[model samples]
Each structure stands twice: as C-alpha cells, then as structure tokens.
Target: MTYYWFAQSVGVLAFMVGITMFFNRSDRRFKQQLSAYSAIIGVHFLMMGAAPAGMSALLNSLRTLISLRTRNHWIMVIFIVLTLVLGLSRAHHWVELLPVGATVVSTWALFRTSGLTTRCIMWCSTCCWVFHNIWLGSIGGSLIEGSFLIMNGFNIIRFRRLQLRGIDPFEVEKKIVKKMEENQAAE
Candidate 1:
C-alpha cells in the first residue's frame, strides 16, 4: 500500500512538470522539459508495474533528448524500430499497446515536425496516454494526460491565431539571433 502511494506521488510530480511543458512557446525548451517529464513518468509507471508503458516513456525521454541534436531520418527509424521491438516484447495485452503507440507518434512528431505541427501531432499521442493511464488505474497519470489534451489544444489554437495575425510564433527566436549577431558585430 505504501509503495503504491509513493508511486502515485512520483506521478503527481510528473503531472506538474508535464503541465508546465505545454506553456513553453519555444520548441527547444518544450522538448527539454518534455524529456524531463518523460523520465519522471517512466519511473512512475515502472514503480506501478506497467512495464510496457514505463519502457516506452523512458525510451521517449532519450528520443526527445536526441531530437534536440538532430532530426536525421535514420535516427528516427532506429528509435521507431527499437521502440516497437522492446515495447511489443513487454506488452501483455492489446491495451498495453496504447503507450507504445503514443510513444511512436511522439517520436515522429519530435523528429519530423516542429512548433505548431509538433503540437498537433502530440495531441493524438496525448489521447493515447489518457486511455493508457485509465487502463493502468493511474489517477495522477490520467489527470495529467487529460490536462495535456486541453492545454495542448489551446496552444495549437494560439499558434494558429498568431499565424492568422501574420505574426510568427517563433519570432522571439529570430530576435534573439539578430541580437547576438549585432553583439558580435559590435565586438
């Protein structure tokens, strides 16, 4: 009983970190935070005895971190293959595939998309996680996934609004780059 509560406590921490991830307008920061959240949730799932979900989450953490360095097609393919083999090997039921599916979709999004498109793809992943958490009886995980659905949807709309307004959602990055260039010229 105490072990169960401890695992739930870790999930609550993941919930907090995961919620903050959606608030990041910068893709790099979002991915960084997502990697951390995935690691935490991976541990949480493992402690709860959801082996497939736990392994998927841990793999996702590493995948997200590597994506920060490169989006090479081969790297993405390797991760996908690895995720499938490992996740499927541990899956005991059809429902166990939910987290594996979620991880696969997320891996694609992180490697092949960015900003608004990435968020849109992740919306699907979030849905899979919601069902997976419910099936696993993880109250904290379910709540976080549900929150991700709503918050991620709102962020997608926000990005679309910026586009409609003829404003780049990533304009801040451009400004930072220009400022750094100016400083270099001054030096």
Candidate 2:
C-alpha cells in the first residue's frame, strides 16, 4: 500500500477512537488520545489522495461502531456477509469494505457483554472479516478494526464503572438530576 493509503486508513481509524474516548467519559488519557487520533483522521481525510470508496468505508464503519443496536451479533453477521457478497465485485469495490469489516465487528465485539448472544456475533464477524479479507488479499481494514477492539476494550472498562455505580451510562445529566429530585421529594 502507498503512504497515502496508510494515512487514509489510519485517519478513518481515528474517528472511531474519538468515539471510544467520549464513551469512556472519565479517562483523560483516552480523551487526549482520541482527540489526537481524530485530528489525524481529519487531516488525512482532507489531504490524502484517496479513493472515495475508502472514505465511504470509513464512514460506514463509524456508523456501525457508534450505532447502539449494532451491539447485537445478528447485525454484525449480516453486515459481514453483505461485505463478503459485495466482494464478488471485480472492480475492486469489494476492497472498500476492508476497513468496515474490521472496525464494525471489532467495535461490536468490544462493547458487547460476555453472554452467548454477544459472543456468537463477535465471533461471527471475526470469521467473516477474516474470510473476506483473505478473498480480497488485504489486511488494511482488519488492522483498522483491530485498533477499535483495543480502544473499545478501554471503553468497556469505563462503562463498567458506570455499571458498578448503578447509573445508566446513556442517561443524560438532566435525567439524572430529575431522578435525584424525585428521590429527595419521596424522602
């Protein structure tokens, strides 16, 4: 791959890293890293002479990683399979899915719990990404996705803190305040 391709791949990888930091909500290190990564991605996205397909792959991967319901295995499976089927394209459009297969399934695997449901899906995605990458003879997207697994692992750690403290991580600040007020009035 060219320098431009590496930069573009890493640049797209950076946006998802930023998402991991935001979700962590309490880790300064993660926040800084995420910011740095996001900036890199932005720079690459703006400056790199990359194919539009690569950019699309990055955006699509971001959607899968950030979208909550994608925590499910079935979606990951379907997406992976769709990516695989698209690989039949002789025009190399299939290569575009490289980043997406890695990032999406990897992110999903990281966020989901250890239950059979989550396990089944992550494993499935892994399989799909592996099979498809081999078919395309590229590792760029898988490498991108692997980074998400690491970043997302940190995100899961941060989420565990909220879980232990008995707060819904997704509950907004005002909702928490309302709950507190209701409790005080009840008392």
Candidate 3:
C-alpha cells in the first residue's frame, strides 16, 4: 500500500509538469518540457508495476529529446520499431498496449510534424494514455492524461486562432528569439 502511494505521489508530480508543458505556446519549450515529463511518468509507471507503460514512457522521453534536434522520418521509424518491440515484449494484456500505441503516435508526430499538426496528433495519443491509466487503476496517471487532453485541446484552439489570424503558430518561437537577441545587442 505504501509503495502504491509513493507511485501515486509521483503521478501527481507528473500531472503538474504535464500541465505546465501543454500550456507553453512555444514548440521548442513544449518539447523540452515534455521530454522531462515523459521520464518522470516512466518512473511512475515502473513503480506501479506496469512494465510496458514504463518502458514506453522512458523510450518516449528519449524520442522527444531526439525529435527536438531533428525531424527525420528515418529516426522516427526507428523509435516506433523500438517502442513496439520493447513495449510488446512486456505487455501481458491489451490495455498494456495502449501506452505503446500512444508512444508510436507521438514519435511520428514529433518527428514528422510541427506546430498545430503536432498538437492535434498528440491529442489522440493523450486519449490512449488516459484509457490505459484508467484501466491500470493509476489515479495520478488518469488525472494527468485527462488534464493533458483538456490543456492540449486549448493549445490546439490557440494555434488555430493564430492560423486564422494569418500568423504561423511556430512564428511565436521566432519572435521570442528575436526579442532575446535584441536585448543582448542592447546590452
């Protein structure tokens, strides 16, 4: 019981991190934070004895980090294959495959897409995770993914609004960089 509580505590922490991650308007910052959140959630699942979900989350952490550096389709394929092999090997039930599926979708989105498309794809992944968490009786996990669905939905709408205004959603990152450079130059 104590062990389970500890796992739940970690899930709560992950919930906070995930909420912050999805709230970011900058793609780069979102990916950066998401990498950390994946690792934390991986630990939470592992401690809960869900090996497949834990493995998928850990792989997702590395995959997200790598995605920040390149959007190469080949690299994405490698991650997908690795996730399937690792996740399926430990999966004992259909519910266990949910995390694997979520990770695969995320791998494709992060490596082959950007901005609004990426978030939209991730919304599907989040749904998979929410179902998996609920099936596994992970209180923290369910809350985290549920919150993620709502937060991610808001971000998608925000991105769409930016698009409707004739502004590229990713342009926000460029504007931040430009302002930072200007400040440095002024100094």
Q: Which one wins on lDDT? A: 1
In terms of TM-score, the best-performing candidate is: 1
RMSD of each: 4.7, 9.5, 5.4
lDDT per residue for candidate 3 within 45-162, as digits (tens), equals 9999999999999999999988766665678899999999999999999999989999999898887666778889999999999999999888878998999999899889987988
Cα lDDT tens digits for candidate 2, 1-187: 8876676566456545544443444222332453455344534533443233334344344434333322344555555555444433323455445444544554455344332233344435545544443454333434434545554555556666666889755446335435544664676
Clashing pairs in 3: none
- Measure candidate 3: CA RMSD: 5.4
Q: How does model 1 score by TM-score?
A: 0.90
Q: Model 2, 43: alpha-carbon shift in Å?
A: 12
Better of 1 and 2 by lDDT: 1
lDDT of 1 by residue, 1-187 (tens): 5999999999999998888788888877988999998999999999999999999999999999998766677899998998899999999989999999989989998877777888999999999999999989897899899999999999899889989999889777446545544664676
lDDT of each: 0.88, 0.45, 0.87
Candidate 1 worst ten-residue window by lDDT: 173-182
TM-score of 2: 0.36
Taking the candidates one at a time, how many backbone clashes does each contain?
Answer: 0, 1, 0
Tell me which of candidates 1 and 3 scores higher on TM-score: 1
Please tell me which model should have the higher lDDT, number 1 or number 3.
Answer: 1
Model 3 Cα shift for residue 75 (angstroms) = 1.9
